[model samples]
Target: MDRRTACLHQANAFREKALADPEHHDQWIDEAIKWLERAMEASCRAVITMEGDDGSDAPAPAFETMAPHRRVIVRQ
Candidate 1:
């Protein structure tokens, strides 16, 4: 599994444990939140590293160089 999926699985496990164990609720909840944040970061990284239609794994353009209306466009 990818980093994002792994992190999400970890988060879910933590959440389930938190719900089931009242004694360590705080610790499990905190861990779950941390894993969720990691998953989100991994997802963002995946999007940034996505290959172009030309099959080239080029880096995405800098946000500063893009116009407001074109910032979301991914050029090949």
Candidate 2:
């Protein structure tokens, strides 16, 4: 098979293995979703500069602005 197809097949096989472990299943799924979302976001960002240099090197959304959508979990 071609290199890309082979890589995809290997990734699918690994994902299947992860899904078989119930204890880690949900966490793995959440991480997979996050990675996919990041990939999509990066692709879109590549199409255009989101904003002109607004003076600061910080993210457009201030930390407070994103607080509402943030997820926090305290582990023992």
Candidate 3:
């Protein structure tokens, strides 16, 4: 998976964890926030890398063809 997608996956995992238990919601949220920040950073990097200076012609990155994400069903 791409870095952004990986980060989002981590965030979702933590969110699922938080939903399953109420004892450490703050911790889970914090982790998710960190992952989200990383995801943003990764996205910025990808944009910069893909669209360098905008003067030269470049093909779209494979990241654009995003596939559907598999939903994780938590047995709550």
Candidate 4:
């Protein structure tokens, strides 16, 4: 599986565990959020890398508009 997928799987696992165990709910939820964020960042980076800067394929506005060191904003 891809890194993104793996990360998402881990997040899901944590989420499930959190639902089952109330004692560690906050900790598991926090871990799940971290994994989900990692997955999202990796997915965004992959998409940016796939789109060449030479404009060979369609223009990637999201990737092109991003500045170095700027975090990508993802809306749920």
Q: What TM-scores do the predictions have?
A: 0.62, 0.38, 0.59, 0.60
Per-residue alpha-carbon lDDT of candidate 4 for residues 35-59, written as tens digits (9 for 90 to 100): 9988877666523333347857676
Best by lDDT: 4
Tens-place lDDT digits, model 3, residues 1-76: 8998999999999998888878998899899899998887766552212435677677744343222343323241
lDDT (C-alpha) at residue 19 in model 2: 83
Positional deviation of residue 2's Cα in model 4 after best superposition, in angstroms:
0.5
lDDT of 1 at 17: 100
**Best first by TM-score, ranked:** 1, 4, 3, 2
Clashes of 4: 0
Clashes of each: 0, 0, 0, 0
Instruction: Say which prediction, candidate 3 or candidate 4, comes out ahead on TM-score.
Output: 4
How do these models rank on lDDT, best leading? 4, 1, 3, 2
Q: How accurate is candidate 2 locally (lDDT)?
A: 0.49
Best by TM-score: 1
Q: Of 2 and 3, which scores higher on TM-score?
A: 3
1 or 4, greater by lDDT: 4
Off by over 4 Å in 2: 1-17, 47-76
- Which residue runs of candidate 1 sit more than 4 Å off their true CA positions? 46-73
**Residues forming the 10-long window of minimal summed lDDT in candidate 1:** 63-72
> For residues 29-69, what per-residue lDDT tens digits would candidate 2 score against the true structure?
66655555544443333112244377987665422222223
**Which of 1 and 2 is the better model by TM-score?**
1
Better of 1 and 3 by TM-score: 1
* Runs with alpha carbons beyond 4 Å of true place in candidate 4: 47-76
